[model samples]
Target: AFKLNYSFEGISRTKPEQNLSGSSKKLTKDVLLQKTHEERRKRQEQRLKLQSAELLQSHIRSYIVRKHKKDQERQLFDEIETTAGIQVILSKLLFFYYPKEDRERLLRIAERLLNIQADVIQQINADKSFAWLIKRFLLLCLKNTKDNQDSMVLMKCLYVFTVDAHTFSYLVSKDYYGHLKRLLESSNNYLQETIVLIQKPFKFIHESDYLSNLVLSEFCTNFLIPSLTHNVKHILVPYIRNQRKEFPFEKLIRYLNTGFHFGKSHSLLYCTLELEPDDYEPNSDSIQVLSKLSANLYELKPTCDLTVEDSDDEEEEDPVSTEKRLLLSEYLKILNRSDKVRKWINFFLKHNHDESVLMAFTNLCHNLLLVYKDSMRKYLLLYKFGLSSTYLKRLWAYLNKNNTGQFETKISSFIAWREYHTTLSVFCDMFTFYTETLTDSETSDTSHTFTQNDLLSMSKLLKNVARGLIEVAFPMCRSSSIPSTPEVQHLYRACLNCVRMLYTLDLRKKFCPSGFWTSDKMHIPPDLARKDYLSKKISSFYGARNEEDEHLPPLSTIEQRSLAILEELPFLVNFNTRFLLLRDLCRNSLGEDDYQRLHHDLMHENVVAIRRTHIYEDAFDKISQKS
Candidate 1:
């Protein structure tokens, strides 16, 4: 059924008219109500749709606000990062040009870039460009004014950070040393402060070959030596003490040799040399380095000339010269620690290149004799015969310079050469007697006892050798001019003792009844004793004998005369006299059974005596001189 609805001012519509009964009327009304309900429900749905639209609009606005805020925040962050980067670049540039003004800011930047406490070294290795920048800034700080605390603080930071061996090379380069020298030279106080700063941290630079070489170059002869001489207590002592940290001695040696071709040697203080045995291996780089260092040290002459003003002058002396700041004696005070003096001498002599250098070194050693006599004597003996008798010649020349001292008598007499030649003649005679005795032994090979001719020959050789040795004694005791000096006296005594040992060896048979001498008496000429000058000198020289020595067994006339002669030449006394005496007795004895003992004795005595007197002699001198 179609239902018709009526509005107040509008027309109502009916789809169709069917029946006008009760059922029709009720159905029409129900349709009208359903239509009304449908309209109201549609309105409610529209209202809900409007509310949903409003909620969505609000959400969109909120999203836009939040996104805008985030964008603004991002923009601000970008600006801050850009400003920081610009600040760093500007600070670096300003510090590079005007370090004293912007030092603090640049230093902070450098610290951040180069000094991350835990990973700083790693960072330095990873960022090459940043490291370069840091390096440039560091140098700027170093080049700043002496009074700038910022520079000092930057240096402290640098020292702390660059101590790492892995990164040290990155912080400094070969060119930096020159900058350091220029910076430090302006003020002595600044120089000392710089040294102090570098000194403590130097211990940590254990590796980095490039840095090692640079450090050595920076502290080369010209720069460090002058500093060292002027400030030994403050500079040199600390540097040497730091050698315990594996300092680059090898590089130091190379630096010393760089200018050696022009006769310009490295100014190496003896204190600076930390030479080890490991530095002296054959055909090694270290050996070459060591040789070079030795040459440099030997040839090094002080650049600053020190003049001695006449005592009569009343003017004040000038400030001490760099060369004269530290004397050779002061150097010796340090070198004496490891017997370095001996090592230095041997090294120079072994690699002999310049005679003038050798002469200078020899002269310096001669001067040491007064203070270090015992050690000097041993050193002299080491070169006495070796190096073509160079040491002997030097010694002789030194002795000839002075006419005073204990050796005045001998030098005045000029009889040492004569006595030496005479002794040589006697030694030849003794050798002839030995050969003759040996010949007789061959003939009487079956006999355990000596023949009459063999014994007579030995006895004659012994007497002649003893007399000749006594003559040699006179000159040796009289030759050294510096008698009051213990060193001169000691050397004189050593030589004289060597002679006495040989003499005693020749006269052993008489002293101990070897039975080689036919009688206890030797036909020593009374005329030999007539020259009482040597005798009285002998007595005065040795001084009064101890009372205990007087109680010994009475000596034969020949023995007494030899003893009297030995007393005048106190320098001739040696502890090895008995060994020498016994060995000679065995060598000349006719008994074949004693040959082995004689050879053994001679070998032992030769080793000990040679060390004292003739070990360093040339082979020809050792063989020909006989003593």
Candidate 2:
């Protein structure tokens, strides 16, 4: 039924109904109330629909924007990775473009991109076209054509490049060394520092390749050694020790070299080098360089042997122990070979050009002569035919000739051409652990091998040096060319005593009925084995007792060479004369901290020596002086 009802609105609602105005009005109201609820529901639905439509529109817009942004980044990465390489990307960054915000962003991205293909690196190096591109990029990266200024591009490139070895190998293969060398001469400290870090991998690259070998040889000969002759201090001591961490490894390598140490330690004092390189030019500014490194050169004190008091007697000190002897022996073990001896002599001769350096050599010589107290003379006799006392005397005179700027030698220097040529001709053979130590059964088959012949030759050489030093020091029988005081005579005699005592052990075989010569190897002369030197004097020593004093056997030049080689034998396996410089250096320069550490190591080295050869008695006092 339809009903109509009165409302606030002028119209009443009716739906197919007939009713009276008064009574029907009540009935209509009930009908209208039921319909009213349906109307309210329709209105609420409309409002909710409008709200949902607004929300859907907003989300769709946001999602489309995000997709576009990601697509742009992906496309940017693809374009850069495909059309061009990272180097191109880096090229866009010129030194002048110092956009702080953008620079930070690029730096972060480059840092994060650590891994790169080695094949790409190889290809880039193989392609010479890349060279032009690289040159242009670097030149552009520089801020200006003049005035020292930092290059962010240089810093960034190296920082990125040195991530690994292949990266460095690639850069080096491209012949970056030439440019790098040029850069090293620059006044800019940062450039030098950055280059140093980059060069670290070069150490590995130089290990096996022939080209690297050639490079190193040339570098040492032309650049390094020449630089040293003139400016050894510049090469050795950092211009600023206070800020040594600032200098590169390359500079340190110069100072770390052998020649530098020889001069700094002993050249100022009176001693001369036996060796001089083929081309040596001392820098005119050497004095200036020395001043820069060591302001108080005179203040530098000499090393003094440390004395530890014995517990048994308050005044007396314990003598060097067997363990100490062993350690010293082991230290010398490295020096036992012919190659090492040759190298030692070569190095000794070259550095011995200066007085201070010569003194260092003497210290080493003393160590060599003293190590095998009893066997030195036998070894000396083994090769005395080739080695000469005159040569040693000449060496000593050259060393002692130079005073502290007060006096210098007037005599012309002599370079042994034969010795020099012989040295230059053969490559130094690498030593073996067993061959050097006399423990390894497998010996290196090379030009230089430690054998009976070597023992004979080197023994002779060492003896010449020892006897020569004594003669020069005392001139008891020989006329004194050098100053000889009573004290000097005593020292010289003591040194002679050391040699004589050791000879007593081997000589006892003749004086004693029992044959003291243990191995027949020691008895053979070099002239018989290898014909190293023609020695006639040894025949008399080999002759009867009456023949020994009556006609003194003068070692021929060749025989003297043999003796010189032999004298250095005891020092072969246990200690090196070279180490004496290092030792004496410690004596003077090493503070308590270094002294304790080095002293401990030395003690350990000595202990090792004693284990190999025990009771190495000072035979000169007991045997040589007796007669």
User: Largest lDDT belongs to which candidate?
Assistant: 1
Question: For model 2, how does the per-residue alpha-carbon lDDT over 370-418 read when each residue is reduced to its tens digit?
Answer: 3332323322321221133322433424422321222111111112222
Worst window of 10 by summed lDDT in candidate 2: 424-433
In model 1, what lDDT does residue 42 have?
100
| Alpha-carbon deviation at 284 in model 1, angstroms | 8.7
Q: Per-prediction TM-score, please?
A: 0.37, 0.26
lDDT of each: 0.44, 0.36
- For candidate 1, write residues 516-558 as lDDT tens digits: 3223333333233322312232322233234433434433334
List clashing residue pairs in candidate 1.
385-617, 386-616, 406-483, 407-480, 493-571, 496-572, 497-572, 504-581, 505-581, 538-568
